[model samples]
Target: MKLNLTTGIIPSLNVSAGLLGFFFVKTWTKFLEKTGWLKQPFTRQENTVIQTCVVASSGIAFSGGFGSYLFGMSSVVANQETNFTDALNVKNPQPAWMIGFLFVVSFIGLFSVVPLRKIMIIDFRLTYPSGTATAHLINSFHTPEGAKVAKKQVKTLGKFFSFSFLWGFFQWFFTAGNNCGFTAFPTFGLQAFNKSFYFDFSATFVGVGMICPHIINVSVLVGSILSWGIMWPLIGNKAGVWYSASLPSSSLSGLQGYKVFISIAMILGDGLYNFVKVLSRTIISLSQEIRIKRKDVLPVADQNLPASPLPSYDDERRTKLFLKDQIPIWFALGGYVTIAILAIIIVPLFFPPLKWYYILVIYIVAPVLAFCNAYGCGLTDWSLASTYGTLAIFTIGAWAGASNGGVLAGLAACGVMMNIVSTASDLSQDFKTGYLTLASPRSMFVSQVIGTAMGCLISPCVFWIFYKAFPDLGLPGSQYPAPYATVFRSMAMLGVEGFSSLPSHCLQFCYGFFFASILINAIRDSVGKKWAQYFPLPMAMAIPFYIGSYFGIDMCVGSLILFVWQKLNRAKADAFGPAVASGLICGDGIWTLPSSVLALAKVNPPICMKFLDSATNARVDAFLLGS
Candidate 1:
């Protein structure tokens, strides 16, 4: 109870309500099937679209989960300086206005990617794993040919959900907490070797590994090995800190440490090159797309975009429904323009505006970053927008200079950059989900609007509850780590001041890696994309540079599971692997709710730390639970 529900915010973030809700929604949709109130035996396409919409809308409605919708965009900055309480003597709804301001700014990126449906979904088949899994989960339940498969999925879903929920409940109540419930298998101690050896039993991550391209798995694994296993010790010894700090700390203490900052400098350098690379590719390709103006496709003069080819969807109405978009580009652009003006002029005046160029840079840099964010999302199942956000804050903050007012302005722009990248990357992935499930782009747009509206109205209230509860959200020993925000906070501070905080070794590593990334990318692009695919991704390499190698290991394990399954039973794995994986993910996500509620109410498990030795821990966990 102390570990899991100590602060009362939800414990598990990966648990999504979409798959769990699918069962109930599916049941409800079927019960009304005969009355023409629903699609009889709800088609996979319809169910997936509706479910996606619901998930997207509800999440965007509030800070429901990490990285989903109510992006802790503010969470990082909250620790820096909270707009949580109104400023002194300001009896204005400044917080409310800022929330609304951010809400409007977010739409700029969300809508920006609509033009790229052709590039992201139609041409390059990025295995957006969750999107693919959700599509499969929806299909498994509804297809007439797969009735048995669907029923089996339902049974497996229930089993997985029950087991995951009960285990998580017991784990939180009984054993340990913090990503540390029997899941991490963390007995090995803090050696780099131990870090390399650990595994994370997250089915959602494994599911992600399952659906994305095998190259991704390989690259991530290679990155983990090359960085964590090989690079750290060299960097540490070079800094002459090996005698004192044998390994990277893996916490904020790690921030000032030589290993982590060296890693950051390297990551930042490579990341900048990769950022430029992707953006250029996106621009060149997008321009080509626009110039050609493919004769088969027309610009959305009549509020419709062409549908991705969905051979499974034979219904004509599906095409009609999917093609129709309610908002026109002109209208959306006009609204965005109005909001940009308000954000730049009116809202900032309340806090006092920065220089004109500061606002101009926020407007300029944000949309440009949005382009490649889609490309990055397509390749890795991640947005890579956070990288953009961190760098943007750093660069823009450095330029804006560090007077009290300038620091505030730079931080404000950091918030904008955060929203811009997050909004673009997040919506792009969700949009891919719609495309895969053959949902209307327009309908998904509306769904996003619903989420955006809900987030605007509700997130502030939800955030206030958490902030009021734990004023120390990002401080030491606080329930909310606001881990990403720590990075943002650091960058904001440094950007305002300069790169003076980075040590000598850190600067050398940064310069070295930055150029190395540039040279590598230039060579790879010269060799053409097919050849480039073999290299470990720069972004993947960056992961283990600061964080531990466990994420790469987990993804590798997940992907390898799929690889082995493919080797053994390719057909069965292709047809049903995703369904099984989705069941695992849904199970974990759904059960987190009850466990969280239990903690919120101050319930404790029967057994706890000192009371349980290895003997008791082992038996009390599996045997007492009868599993």
Candidate 2:
């Protein structure tokens, strides 16, 4: 929870809890073995079970969106909006309801993807990079030669982890107030800083850059340059012409509206394109598979004129066990239907404005969306659960209307959609890991269920502590700003209020960007993969439009580091890059635990590190001398 919240606030630093959990469990298990506490050697399969459980449980933190959807319902957003209403105002989250809401929505995703495991993992052969990486990490730990490499990797991880933690501690002392530390450093210049172009000194984002593909990192940087450097400046010049000059800079009626809506437009355009493309491919693939199967079953006079070429030894063994415990199709369907009914009945009882039919409609369409998300994750290792959630937010929020608590309804629907879509993808990723590890499919599924059950209870409890301890938990400029909360809330507002709320020319800009995104994606696809890799992804570019480019700077720094390391020693960089990156990420992420405690204790940092222009500094000095 601490690590996720820390990373989630920044762009492109959302490290997987499972990846971090792997390090902790591996270290602990090694300690136990060394101390002679274990009766038998800790097998790779057992390690996999632990990893699956961790991923499942920690996933709750990501999906729960305490910092995003839940926070969007809070007073922070209400305070920010000019035309707030009672319907838009939600009470503080209660633990009981939070737990219940998560439980209802989380498991539906698990069952939703069960029937498609073979199709996704076996037939499609999509490269789930994160899952495949994890499987390799686990596999390496249990081998004699690999064990030696693992030890060196662990040592590298520890060294960097210590350094990253201490660095965070050093940085914390200067952050006594808002924008008062290295995070707010004006690395470029005062003008650039005003445009939100600066190095935040965030280790987590740097680590994320190391882990993420080069295209994603570069795309973010390009997006920042386009929006902040050229587009926003051009738009800002139209202040008095395009919007009211007297309006505060933050007003959505002015520049803020353009930022949020334009970003949303690009995101939607990119997501829609990919969703159509992936769905079309999936249908074609499935049709071909059916035809092949039908042909095989038809008249083959020779029982097997020539048997199909045998699979490789490891592949054959893994497939045998994977197929050994087939979760019945009926079971998957029955479980999904049962959960859907429960959610439809129970959710309206808690959130009446959402209506029963709304839930029914969402549930009906959710499975298809879940498959799209899962399949997309397999291909790109990027889960667009939030994009799907945004779709729900607009569709449902608009349907419910502003007079009928549309904001809350939209957020609630988002939770349901996000959890199902997210978990479906996560479970599929774990299935891929299981397939590679040669772990039993039944064990993987059961472990995920157990972990999810644990998460339902644990995630809300963890979030509750943050909610109570931090007085300004979701407020802008606070430690945990929960940036996406504002974005989601703005989306709900736009959905309900319609284009009448947008500033002059905002709608036109949105339209241009929307079509531009689609066109860019079309061109990228039309070009061969060799050239397409260089194209900036619309989705990746859209993120920094709303969130600022500071994190992009951090990520590029990470990319630079990795590039240099690879140049110096490609083999070692390939071997130890993730471990080093994980160290930096985990170390800084874990610091959130103590930082939260300090906030609870009301311990202020000793110094306020801030920068000022020469004129301001001279004035301060003159005033001090006079006094």
Candidate 3:
């Protein structure tokens, strides 16, 4: 059973909701400040309820959106069929209560912040300040004059976001209007590919995935070296052995079985590795907890060698020792460990759960993975790490055993989930930072959640809508098989059937994992110190080349723009760049939703097709004749 919905609908609703919420919160915060009900952070106090709400909301929203993106990207890149998208339609294409159910769940999730805040930050001191954006927003409220200036800046950002939303919408409209369009002069189309040349490091996707220039340069070269430089030529001579004599009749029906298998293996392997890592660390950390007092996972005291001889396990000690010389590493380590455990136990029980270990693993291991992910990728935003952690737990829990295949399916789920969650967590941290320093938590929370939920719901709906919108030509259908979904289908293939055999493609990911691990480690070591210690090439490989390229492009452009702005007018850039980025993100929600809806509605195929043809034709004309 498959749910038939358009991707655009979710985004449209999210954007609309986010705008309203953001505006409402902003207005309320201002009114509260003016009436002396609340004093701003920069003005005096260290914290306030309103400020906390703003920052926390940012964290939640960012986590939700980025989390969904990571899961969707995993499915998209792996070309998998199963994911959050498919989950909605599992056994019920048009579930009578899905939208209503989701709305209820989301609404319940909202109140979670107020109570959770007291426990997480006030009691546990978790430093869940991944809401760096919110922190920044709070920072803006220092003085009356500064507040006015910041408010004006927010308005400006809001307008810029509007423009971005319009641009994204127009772009989507044009692209969706046709499957592929050719420009006579440039000979390019939105969906064009190079079949003759299998290796293209220069593709827009590779850049967009945030493949650092250096890594992209190396990875593509290596993959090409394997596939093109060596394997393709070998296959040319042994084509009969490698492929069937006759090509398959249906492109849609001809699933890329091997690709799906590899994707599952990657997910499983990563997930397992992370699960082990997190469980071990938390078990050791929680030696004090009554549940684990009988067993000993921690290192025996005094029996161990000096900390300097081996790797130092003490986080604070490592930090202080590296930076100043005052605080002992144990001080930071103890607090960090306590908070990690508390967060682990608390989160999944959004309503209390019977099993504490599950929540502990989700909370503790998830965030560490997120932190590692951000540092590994050079994203360097804590918010991203936190959000990534949250997503990792959810995705892995939901899909690990069901979707990932081959040996150690559970392990694979843990590993893949950890990495994905970590990345999402880091992004959330960035969002929080954006709001904390400038905006109120209430505003940030509402907008962020709306955006995230929108992304999550729309991605799957969009694909389905596209399939319906454009009836398969039966030549080469646009409805590519969902990669992860295929992996889930392959779980049965691992059975004891005589024909069953280990998936050959699964080895590629292991190869990728080992190869990337070694390569990144080497790069870090070459830099002398551990400054480059956390690179996550293995995780990057789990993602597809296109998404990786997109991330790379996104990071490069963003970092470069920030660098330039900082150099030219540090004050203005610092004051307003975040707002600009926020606006851009919000705008994406606005434009993407409606356009995707149009694509999904199955309104009129021939008419829509004609519109697409005209749009493409016009573009070609412009390119060729010079518009």
Candidate 4:
């Protein structure tokens, strides 16, 4: 629920919630061992299976996009648009249909990448950082010496978890009304707070900061400063000049237009740059590999030696097991075709705007794109699934045209494309983990399938809870504003309506940022790593342009804490930092369940801890005294 809400609001900060699940599993297994409840010791390979399953299941939450593509279809977004017609509005899918849609579409991607696992993991040697890290973590837990470190890490996790949960509970008491509590605290005075510059005391983001690289957090902070601190205020001064003065603040023709479009511009710019870069790298690398393989002869010394040096015993053993139970190429191909056919037939029953032909076309082209996404994820540990999804929105939405419910068609298409591309990359990453841990390929595949099935049911139910509990969800200024929903919806609208939909000067700003983002990427690449490492990511910066800097501030605080900890003791910080951060995130996240229940029950916080300036306080005091 926490991940869904946070990632919905800011898709870029999607952390792996599976790590938290892995922690619980590790702890539980330890407890079971102590109690002599287990017949066999929990092996590292088994731990890998649990991690794979947990990741695959939790991953469904992200692919579902309750906060982005799914939410974009809601009335909340339709109402936000000035020119949105009733004919174009799409009702949110019912929970049952959502489950069905997710179930049917989810597995297609799993099969799509099954054929490439060996090539990606062995031949390309893609890092797949998350998977490799999880493998290492599992290995550590099963070792004697590492057990001592694990105990300390678990203890630290527990301490922080308790504190984080208590902090959330404390904050809840003061959040009786809008702009109430420490969340709305004006750490930098009222003006900066109003600009969304103050920290919201979000433990989730703080934990996220610790987990994410420093560049991401810094990029967000930089983006916030550029947008809220500078660009927004400057744009506001031209409200009547650039657009109608009579327009509401929320109107797309006014300040909101600038915010949405410019952010989109930057996002697209960064995405395009990275996409091209990765594609070029993949093509070049593949060609080089082919060329090398095609060589018919070797030097005399090399020819006399074995074709390849013998792998270490561990590597050879792992390779043997990985290849022992290979999933047949025919099965993968057949399963993909079968699922594609089912999706083409079934999905339209729920979302009629997306024509069967569109699904067919996307499926036909998706495998190649999925491969690209998976390969890119291997090289960079960054999946551009959303980028590919955005491409679908523009291409399909434009093809559909506005008169034919293009908005709904585009969003639906995005769901299909995103799920396929995202799951492909994710599965590949898991394969890498399996390779490292010597887990059987067949077992990993089965776990992923089972996990995916579970996610199909669980993600929608979880989202349904949020949808039912929070009446104001997806609305601007609400807790889960689902920032990407608006951005994506707007992209579809732009595709259908073209530049005419943009407010005056908005297109110009977009053009400027679009090129600026490309330029920034180019410079980041050209510069040496020493300087490039310090550069802010255009994609990261673009997020805060819409959502505000509260989360960014929280992340920076997390980074600060980590920095201090590292300075004190680098080894301990490096070893236990993720555990502590995960604890903080998990504790705060678990609190969401109770909070939602309270909200649904119509129970409000006991106090509205609002802040007031001196004059207002004096006026209130005088009035009370006289009365």
Candidate 5:
């Protein structure tokens, strides 16, 4: 209870409890079905467990997932400032407007999306595939004798839970440090050989194989080649003198300015490229839809025009209901409009006299971006959607009060939001498959959403705690020299600078152009089978080279293992993947939830002393063995 309250784990705890409680409800439902208690045609819908799980999961997942990315972006923003300083120092761990927005919006989204289940699931058949997976597990116990089998499965899951708990603790205490990097100990100069390095001797590879698509996995590899193999070495060596002066003595002294510059350039470039592609695609798509509708209307007109006995096209079909086609657009538009209206009102509240044009621009670009995201998710090109959205926001910002901090912050917020939407859409796609396989849509939806929310709430708090705990990293406060804040502050400094193009705006536009060229080319090529997928490739390039490299290798290894296992024993390997994924998720809880607890407890255990000692011993042992 103490840990639960302190860590904000209560909500998630409630979620888990709720899930378990629903199991009993499911059991009863099954019993009712077996006994013909409810004589409905459809499988006597078991709502309690699945719906509860979906709502809980979506909220948690969106929150946590959004939080993690928010932290990542904020870190980048903060580091932007730290990079320029001779000896950087970050301020108090203040939450940004974006963070607050995410917190409030995520909860609302959680609730909002629930009402959508009926629309998305029952009416439109949106295929809640994850629910199908859960249902399979539940229905496995159904028979003439009631839910005796389900109770046994629950017991089995409980056993797994116990092991999962122990595993989480061990990793938390022994290996994980700062929840930042992988591995437990340093192996050599500026390098470490930990879980960060190995995929636990192929276990991670197997897991990676299950999740990562072939295109993305390949893109990641390509990105690693560009970033780590080409760019990092080339840029670092070419500008060695600047690096020598600017960088700290320790490689990890802190995030260096040069590194930040390069990263900013890459993401900016990639995002711009994606935006143009998306905009063009959206325009074309909307045009086509309009054309199709027009075609129908015009044909009807042609027939009705003259007092002709025969129709013009000879097909006697009138347009029925294109209702299905409208559903996706409506949902996408509704989400965008709501967020845009809120943003418009909120921004004005913070700084009054907001132009209606500002709101209109946001509303316009937002749904276009959302459509791109939803469509991209369908194609499994998450990279394309995110970059496109980022670019769209950047372009819109440039048109709007481009120089303002609010605009830049809004840009960042939009970037983060678009990324989550892409992820959610991707999950939705996965659930589509799961649903086809008879998986439980409700359960899957709940699980994922809950995971996202948990991520959001926990990430900010964890960020704050870590920022406070390690002041040396120049964390906690605005790291980017508060660039957005500076942008805002400059408003007062320059009386004439209102609503005009700033120097930063020029840079943003230039970068956007450069990106647009590359993105357009890539999209053009990717249309046919002769070309390599370029959007995700650039995205893969944009992420940290090391992380991308690891992911690539992990995916490759996992793919290999899956191939071998499936060839030898199909059913076992299939089951194994889910089990491992579940384990990792359960295992992750060890560190994720506990940090919040420890911070709240105020257990000032000298983490540095303990970390250094353990790391040192591990290194010495490795060295001795090597010698």
Candidate 6:
């Protein structure tokens, strides 16, 4: 009810309030439609939903990924009693120069992808699923005769949103108080199964099952089975040499640690292999087609805010020479050169430089890594930035130092590359969104650049708010797991303090996982995709290992709902299935707003955070559900 600035509580409160307010407006609009108060087939309310979703999406983009590690210091110099503000420099929301450097780097990422635009979007025509879904939702709102369909959709979406919001209360509030309602059934019996094999039950995850292609779902199931059903039981039986029972496992929980290690390796391995496979095949395939296949669920907007006056290429030769409406070569070249000089050559001059060439290497590697991430997204719709960033850690391994300067540089390089990858992937997906809905790609480009500038400033504030609210981050049973920071920290420790201090088997398993992922992907690609459809996607398989079985179970069941419905009536399935799934996603997705508030209030997360604690019989804590 009250505001707290020092605690970073205001930003999350604002977000939660906005989503609640939007839900109310949506409900009122539907009531108006029913009474005929809104005439002309809902002409007055057009563009309302799309605009709201866009804003929500932008806020989410601002919060996505481990953007915190950009400034979070894992190598803290303070005691347990030291206040968090004192420990992490307690400076401004973020370093100002870092903000400037991010802006230049983000802009450079946009510019660097110009050549890739021609090759991936124009020539190969990859269909990014989420982008297509967004395009479809937008098109539904704007097209002629789309108003009626979209109006109906709005009402349906609102009902589900309200339904899911209440449901989220059961999941979070009640669960925190140790009454998770029906969803807690999975944890009732079977200690091994509950702790190791439980699947989350929620409309949102079920919605995911309904929406994702069956092939992807099947792969997810395979991955889940391999880890929880097989690997988990194996670990319980053996307590194997590769998994030390005594090793620190707070950030990366128990058997879950091995799961995280192997899974990450597999994801990176498979993703890396897929990148090469996609890149090579696209080259061969491009020669066969002049233009690639592309989508629209426009179920078309000519709108892109912050519109730039892109040069209209009237020359036939110019059109033939490059993709239509491409950003001018001079602008690309000019932007790249200017940003590179500042980011690569000038920025690092401030601090005492050790291996000044590291920045240069990052300058060279970033764009290439960005392109690889974009390509992977086009092919898989999964961000490979984490994988690439992990790769960067190893790539820079031998050169990292014991001094603070070297670790800082490594984290900087990771941040720069990740920021670029995240930016580029978002751009590529938006480009796909534009292509499907008949929107102007160049105009979308202008809108994205504007958004990037805003994100450069806003993301830090969102991150810091979470930091201030949750003081003991990365501690066991705490909400902010911050696995990526842990990864970066481990890499630094290994480099600075040496490997003898780390769990030996953990490292070995990680490498084995890395290689196994690569090998499985190679075999799958070689066998032909038709056959590969039956095999699990290594990335899909690996993700579930770390994410817990509960989510995997919910997602699998959601997929089955869609699969069975399609089999029953394929045509009608198209008309209603997506709407239902959309409702579930909308409901549960924004529900995080209130959840964040509860979290900041120390409203207590469901027993799940402390599930391991009670399950392990550690001294009972007050936070544990039903404790």
Which candidate gets the maximum TM-score versus the true structure?
A: 4
Looking at candidate 3, what is the lDDT of residue 325? 21
Give candidate 1 misplaced runs (Cα > 4 Å).
1-23, 34-49, 58-104, 110-143, 146-151, 176-197, 200-255, 286-326, 345-357, 364-384, 405-408, 421-442, 455-482, 517-534, 590-627
Better of 3 and 6 by lDDT: 6
Candidate 6, 53-154: lDDT as tens digits: 343234333323333334334432111112222322222234465455566556677777765776676556676765666656555555556556645555
lDDT of 4 by residue, 1-627 (tens): 565555443322112343444456677877998898976766766777777787788788888878788878887777787665465647665898889889888999999999998889877677888778777876776788776777777778888889899999989999988889988999999888889889788888888889878888899999999999999999888867888888876677788889889999999999999999999988898887776666535444445434656689988787788888799999999999999999999998888778899999999999999999999888888899989999999999888888888888898899999999999998998898889988888899999999899989888887887888888777767787778888888988888889998888889999999999999999999998999988899998998898888889999899889999999999989988887887788789878878888898999999999888899899999999999
Give the candidates in order of TM-score, highest first: 4, 2, 6, 1, 5, 3
Give model 6's TM-score versus the native structure.
0.70
Each model's lDDT: 0.54, 0.82, 0.36, 0.84, 0.41, 0.55
Selected candidate, larger TM-score, 3 vs 4: 4
**Can you write out model 3's per-residue Cα lDDT over 1-627, one digit (the tens) per residue?**
011111100111112222233445667767998999977522312233333333333332323322222222232322222222232112222222222222222222232232222222222223333343344344445556755876666686578677766665444433433332210111222222221122221112221222133343334334333433344345345433544324342211122333333434444445445444444533443333433333334566445534424434543342333233222345435644564455344432322221345444554454345334433322222222322432433444343333332112222233234333432333334333422333333443444445445533553344344334434311112322222332332332232121223323334544565445555545764776455634443333443321112223333454456567779999987676555555655565455456546656744223222213467788988899984
Q: Which tens-of-lDDT digit does each residue in 439-542 have in candidate 2?
A: 88888999999999998998898787788777776664456666677777787888887888889988998899999999999999999899999899998898
Q: What is the lDDT of residue 573 in candidate 3?
A: 73
lDDT of 3: 0.36
Model 1: per-residue Cα lDDT over 494-563, one tens digit each: 5665666554456566667667666766776688888987765554455455445665666677788888
Total backbone collisions for each predicted model:
3, 0, 104, 0, 50, 8
Choose 1 or 6, whichever is better by TM-score: 6
lDDT of 3 at 456: 38
Model 5 misplacement above 4 A: 1-100, 103-165, 175-182, 185-209, 218-222, 229-231, 238-244, 249-343, 347-357, 375-385, 396-536, 546-560, 599-627
Question: Which ranges of candidate 2 are over 4 A from the true structure?
Answer: 1-37, 88-91, 123-127, 301-308, 328-331, 379-382, 465-479
